[model samples]
Target: MLLVMTGIAAFPWPAATAQQKGGFRKLAPGVLTVIPPDKSSADELLHGDLLEVTEGLSGPPENLAWEPQRSPANTTLVERARNRSFARDIWCLEFAFKPPRMIEVDVPAADLKMQRKRVWYLVYRVKNTGGRRTVVDKDDPTKFKTETFETPVRFIPHFVLESLEPLSDAEELAKYRAYLDRVVPTAMEAIQRREDPRQRFYNSAEMVAKEIAFGEERWGVAVWTDVDPRIDFFSIYASGLTNSIRWRKRQGAVINPNDIPGSDMEVAMESLRLDFWLPAAGGNAAEQEMSVGYRGMFERMTLGSRVLEATGWPKTTKSNPAAALERMGLKWGDLLEPVGGGGPSMQPLEKVLTTIAGLKDPAIRTALVREMFGDVGEAALESLAAAAAGPVDTEQDKRRRAALQTMGLTPEQVAKDPYKSLARIVGAMDSQPGYAQRQAMAFKCFGPAGRRLEWLSKGAKAARALAAMESIAIDPNSVATGNAQTAFEAVRPSISALADEAERRKVLQGVFGPRGPDLFAAAVAVHEGIDHDWVFRYESDGPGL
Candidate 1:
């Protein structure tokens, strides 16, 4: 028989033997001593009506190694002597089982109607060491820094048992062996992956806790009787190992009491907690019935006193009388107060205008607009164009305008179409210093829809003008086929006009490539009609080049 009783106790020093007791035998500086009930005289000590200390700092050392050769492991205790070796005069306590319990058993039934099976149980205990409090000061030795201390530890006793019964049929038994062969290697691989000792310990604890409570009382025996003839016993055990690891990994990730709550901490904790328990007992398991109970208890016991008091909902504190007049959803600059005299607090909605109007800092304004209106359509585009035309000399404004034009609106199109509200702002780009940039923007926008090529082609400087023509010809969806043909016709006369072969090849490739085959063919015809000494190389890797 194995019996173990472990707890903490403390007592006052006797005046006569005070010197012999070693002056309170400091467990900690102000903390004093921790005494344990005599292990040999436990029976007499209990009957002595001695003051039983339910809680204290003395039980076992905090750090101890388990020796396998020792018997009745619970009886082994390790302790550290009080000295100046520690920063705060702390001591460690450790307990271990020397002769580990043999918990695996095979039972035989005398009657044919009774079932025979194997049962396994693993038993272990954990001891929690209380933390300490201290005071220290760097600048002033007299003025000490005070620290509150408490042990945030709990001891848990655990046992696990698994019952295995042989299959009644030969076919099912063979299938079970085959399944085990395939799964045992994978189970070993998972076990090898858990490198942390704490992880391994916690996993073992969770399994023992779960197996001991399966389908009986919260703490009771698990039995498999009148065994099913078809169930594969080995496969069930093999798969259980894999499932147990998954359960442990998930449990380890949950937020315990050691975690501090933040603004979203509760929500995150609840989510992880729920996720952890979902596979166990199928999501509706009671708190007491799940692994979270022990973890939750530890958290509440340690940190519950420090939890912040909940306050009622906040009352609005704005003192301005006009604040009450503001609409609930009205944004910061949505004209909540009248713009001039009493018209409406806000303007009539036509489009989604960005509120960052006339912002002096272009980068700040662009960022604000992007934040508020990146998802808005034409109104945001018009507002950005207007901002670009403002006095601010910001590169962001130039980029915004370029982006707007690339989105497909020419100044003329904006002027003539129903979306002509921002016509003046769109037209202003033509006269801006970034004319080449504007022309490129116009080509990108108009070329795709085949509508604004004429305006793009009529642009300012020679270099920009040629580049605009190239942009239009390369557009896959360019609608101005005739204008594209005309531009190619105009460039054909200068193909061999004493220019570099690379530039000529580039132009030829652009016209003849995938983007504009018709234009390329037209250029070829014009070249052939002039009987120029131009050689076109066409390579065929297949039947059709």
Candidate 2:
């Protein structure tokens, strides 16, 4: 990552009689020596043998003995040649710098002392040193080689300038600003025109060392002229005056590993802050940087049709809610029948008889049916009597006849007033193996508008019973908003009486779990009605609450 240019000891100027012959010589492992082809090429030479070094070191040998040549123009000429011929190993050229001279460098007062009159030019070189060929057989303009087995190389430049003085007058400051504006655009143009694929997206970042002045820090302005526009990069102003540079060095990039996907947004915003805002603030502003990171992520997730397919969710359609419900295998009556009984309902009353009847778990079914259906309902009573009177010997048929007998309901009575006879069937649900089934059935009959609130008020003690009542009130298809509000009012007192947090949570779950949107609003209202702090605390607990 270093570039070095040094003056070498003068060597004897060769005569015309000397023969010219030069080629590469391996001086050491990975080191090579380059000899000038003729004595004329060697005359007043700053470098006699070119030495190849590795990356990471800073400069070349200090004093190799050679005959001294005596001429000023010759000295200048030799210096330029040394600068050109003193190339480092191409692989190691991550950074390059122009050697420091005794010239003056403008910088800010804070950075004035630290600024050095040295400028460095560097290009990040990615070299293909492997013997294998690439999978894609195409020429890469950014690269030096494109053929299979050819060594590919691309360069990204870096320029470093040290020790600058601040501008002394307004005119100088304006000139410096204008200069920067011109240089940045020019550098971006060069990057855009680069044909190398590897260099096409390369970005440039400038570091103005501590010694540079805000007004006079023009030491490294031209370096900004050669950067690629497409590459996203930023510059850091290292102010030496107030120890800002020290702080930056200590902080480095404040990355938190725990932040994960979201933190990358923070990093990008930080870069943007340094590039656009730091200069105006003199490097000490404390405002938090704003970013589009999460917003952008959300946009990508929701806006595009492709993301929906990727996540296994169906694309949203403009069809109305009724159409969507039908697609889900639901119908209007299925949601509304528990409140009224004026007409013949759907034939699958067994399925709609109660939530308990639909349950696969016999134990839970027994618990639910027993608590909710205390006796056979008119619907169930009719179904049972019809099955019992029919000539049937199947185990299911026997079970039905035994259920009617246990409930003290004869086949004739069951048929005469099946709905009225529901009381006895519900009572049988509370006995032995049917309790769970009764509870489940109660859940099923709790739909909105189909059943009367007066009937529900009778069994509002059990959490599941209260839940069914509320379910009927909040059914989306029902005109039971008044009933739902009344139910909420009725249940709140019972829920408040619960002594244990766990029991209260269970009641709340039943209320809110089945009718989420309605209950959410009710809960929020209750929380606010008592204390504003409660509302804040509940929301702050996040979705986990």
lDDT top scorer: 2
Estimate, for each residue in 1-74, the C-alpha lDDT of model 1 and write its tens digit.
00111112222212221111112111234221122111221111121110011011132332233444757544
lDDT of 2 by residue, 1-545 (tens): 01222211122212222222323122244221111111111122222211121110113342222334675542432232343322111111111111111112232236445432211122221212312211322575443321222122222222222111112211110111211222233333333343222222233433222212111111122233222222111222211111000001112233232323222221100000011111222232222221111111211111111111111111121112233223334343333222112211122222223433345665654444333433333233334435434445466445555556666765566566543344445444433233235444333322222233222221221222223333334332222223333434444455556678755544343333322222333343432122101011121222211
Q: Which stretches of candidate 1 lie above 4 Å from their native place?
A: 1-191, 194-211, 214-411, 415-545
Compared with the true structure, model 1 gives a TM-score of 0.15
Candidate 2 steric clashes: 80
Residue 4 deviation, candidate 2, in Å?
67
Q: Each prediction's Cα lDDT score?
A: 0.25, 0.27
Residue 172 in model 2: lDDT: 10
lDDT of 2 at 83: 35
TM-score between candidate 2 and the true structure? 0.18
Estimated TM-score for each candidate: 0.15, 0.18
What lDDT, from 0 to 1, does candidate 1 have? 0.25
